[model samples]
Target: MENHALKSWPDVAPKLVAVAAGRAPADTVLKGGAWVNVHTREVLENHDIAIAEGRFAYCGPDASHCIGPDTQVIDCAGQYMIPGLCDAHMHIESGMLTPAEFARAVAPHGTTSMFTDPHEIANVMGLEGVRLMHDEALLQPINIFTQMPSCAPSAPGLETTGFEITPDDVAEAMTWPGIIGLGEMMNFPGVVNADPKMLAEIAATQRAGKAVGGHYASPDLGPAFHAYAAGGPADDHEGTCEADAIARTRQGMRHMMRLGSAWYDVETQITAVTEKGLDPRNFILCTDDCHSGTLVNDGHMNRVVRHAIECGCDPLIALQMATINTATHFGLERELGSISPGRRADVILTSDLGTLPIHRVIARGVTVAIEGEMKVDCPHLDWPAHARDTVHMGRALSGADFEIAAPAGANHVTANVIGVVENQAPTKALKAELKVQDGLVPGDPEQDVCQIALVERHQATGGVVNAFVSGFGYTGQMAMASTVAHDSHHMIVVGTSHADMALAANRLQEVGGGVTIWKDGKELALVELPIAGLMSDAPATEVAAKADKMVQAMEACGCTLNNAYMQHSLLALVVIPELRISDLGLVDVRTFELTPLFDEGQDQ
Candidate 1:
């Protein structure tokens, strides 16, 4: 019923002619080129390729016999013809765009393939959300592979999701044409501990002969990591260092190095192949979460490829990581990934191997991107009604709602504070002494302490978790709030002033849902993400412009980090690290325990 390229596909006359004459179809022959062959791990000089029906008919020393008088051929002028790049692991929702728009944004970056996990949307909308994403992805011109989201709440019992994804969901999704594998098993602890739900999902993927993606965020690599590997996640992209890469690959897991808007992971981890001299085949490149800002400005897999080369990685090996390694990981090797015969004719023409200056991109034998702009229209999906109105802030909030009340008359008290590092995903669990004023836990400006609130938007149950945070560099009246909190999908609002916090939070709900910047009792900017209170349907450029404005607003508010909003959004994601905030309360992420908002001497 389905044309799984693994079996058979209808051949257009080109392949037959190539097979008969011992030459590939030159429907569009790229001549006078150097083929960067991932299979041979070498760049073959003076090569030619023939394309047919959006598939590579052949790539070798010659394609002359397949070229007819009607065949169109382009002279590469002796440039490097490389396979289109692939993002081994990523989240389409993380870009804050639908799959269709996300495709349009990255297609020009020579990223012909992507292995995406929609866990963010899954947390809010569950199986239906993932299904929508999967169905839409199949319509894209490029290879957009969807991974069945493994963790909906991410941590069962620790947090609650609007909808739950069961093993039945996983088993059913496996039959979909676009599903490549299971999404990152974020519940590594559950898997390692033999939790039935986690095991069931992994089992379904394995049973279906699909890969199980990994996300062991912890740096341990002790019994926990060993037990997790035993649980069967085939590849991991959470590694942030060379040693992390070494450990994952040594345990028979593909180490996926990522580079994104906020995450600078590739340069630090690629040394597994470059310096440690590990087998390059085990490495792959990814953009775990490329925000609209990154896709519009920085480039997608192209950025990773360029960064890998900067890290002293061999250009050929880097291409393999971005192409074949990714395809092979998701059981798509025979269908896509390379410039070999029978594969999707996804290729990029670049003048310099090291620089990776993408001059042209070809997908399925069709020229899609010439220079930097898209040359064709990427189709769109008719998103459902529920997907557009997911923000449900039960009631409006005032300054008092965000205030932290202290025990009767305690003067100075110790409290659990979230300490933000400069540009990392993890947070610091900090215990600090703070002063109390009028039966309230007052923030210490000297300690960079500011208020953080988690507004429960899922059920409109009127729940709010108030806490303290550092590293926003707030010096004046300002606040930032968004419903884009990861994993739990709550509204994370941070501010130096309670008045600004209340205003920012209420404004987001008024706009359905989105991030808002407020300073000096005035609203600075807004990016209306009507969908799930998390993403906007606006074009990538439109989203990027608003995001840039947000960055400027943060700068205006004296908050300084590479991408402070990205850092801000991660503050409530309890699964990743040391500290976080949830609708339940302040979370000690390492222990996954409920920490008191203020010191023991203070009130809850």
Candidate 2:
């Protein structure tokens, strides 16, 4: 089917006017519902909405005049008719499903719009990968705007990606048909330092009159912060505190508070508006990165909206944050985010506003979903073999491949460990005193310290950078490996036993690419993601079930953190926080430089 759903408003204007004026029948009319007027922040009862040509023709107290024999009338029956939810920022690959499957999973939950950054795929497959994602996204019934990735490595010079995005890439992508803007500018330091390439990318986006997604992950609200603001990003989602929210909004940037699968940044930052009384319009709700289980078992934007309400935000205010605020941030206020005339016919029927039970979802003049059932087909793309075959571990890895050798004659060593903060992206640059065993450093399970390895997958060269990490509470002979390592998309293996770690990493390579957990030298669970080694071609439900098993396997290994698998995947991400592992070495993200694993004064 053709996706004329997002066609120009003028193309549908005549049909809409005919239906609005009672001259012609509407395609669909939703009657007897309490309309959520986001424009006025009020709910008007006994309202009817007329839809024609995939757009809202009229929304008012009465639409009986436009109803004809063929016009399908949905009886809302006193249900609250709210605008379809919009995700301001997210990654489709995070769901571990292709765009088609992701859309199918969320449509039942009332999410009709998504502004997704294909940066993960871009990191693995470059511009061609992004185009593949974009093409599939446009085929969905809902809005899934593609943002050209501004940073492929996320932190250039700190991490290397299989494919690097250049300024020319940004400029070229701005001209794509479905391109909305540039993806998150993850190279915040580059922007602050006036890096010519970074500046050129930002300038290209601005010149094309598109939004520039931001990622200022630093906590410093000083000169570096202001300099980043001046570098021309329109919105940011890396804020973790109330001050971070307030600072970005005060600087005319939209503060996006996200509640993803593992990231719980909304509670602290929403306080900026709830407690501090900052303008709610400057704040938006999003799910930056959610895995398949989170999208299927939990809701999408619906979940985020509920969390905001639980945080003392008024229900309508929370809805506004998810809908109009997001649409306005992306300059799509006129086209969506409300039950208004001339906008896309996207609405949700809920029994209650506070505890929103998405009873029905209408997108583009069609009832796409109802009562947790799909009423339409979300199209898919035939992924090529090149996309499927991505994992390239030059040779088979052994137990010695994960060994962290100590200095000569050292019995013990003080090493820097990447400490995982629960439910947050930032890691703590921690120090630990580890005993040397047979001239090798061993992870202390009692102290929650485990060995983490970054296996270079892009090149055939066998490169493994090992480091120590704390906070997973991993015990016994267990290892977790994934090719979905954030930003750079390398293979990350974290385990207490070198044998288990080697087995886990090789398992991923054997299956092309995916996440795997090993216990007692046996494969416990594996979620095969054959697409760029980042997303699976399987259905969302199947993927979610596999991901659930992965989580359970991690828990069985004595590691208990909410979505610990997500934390495991990001251990190799060298962009955010205090410390992280990379192909180069363990990077001190605070200093944006590689630091030595072993410190001075060891018992050598």
**Cα lDDT listed for each candidate:** 0.85, 0.92
Give a tens-digit lDDT track for model 2, residues 324-417. 9988988889999999999999999999998899999999878899998999998888888899988898989999999999999999999999
Off by over 4 Å in 2: 1-6
In candidate 1, the residue pairs with backbone N, CA or C atoms under 3 Å apart (3 or more residues apart, or in different chains) clash, namely 54-364, 414-599, 415-599
Compose the digit string of candidate 1's lDDT tens values, residues 359-428: 9999877788988899877777688888887878789999899889886667778888999877578888
TM-score each candidate.
Answer: 0.96, 0.99
**Judged by TM-score, which candidate is best?**
2
Those runs of model 1 whose alpha carbons end farther than 4 Å from true positions after fitting are 1-25, 602-604
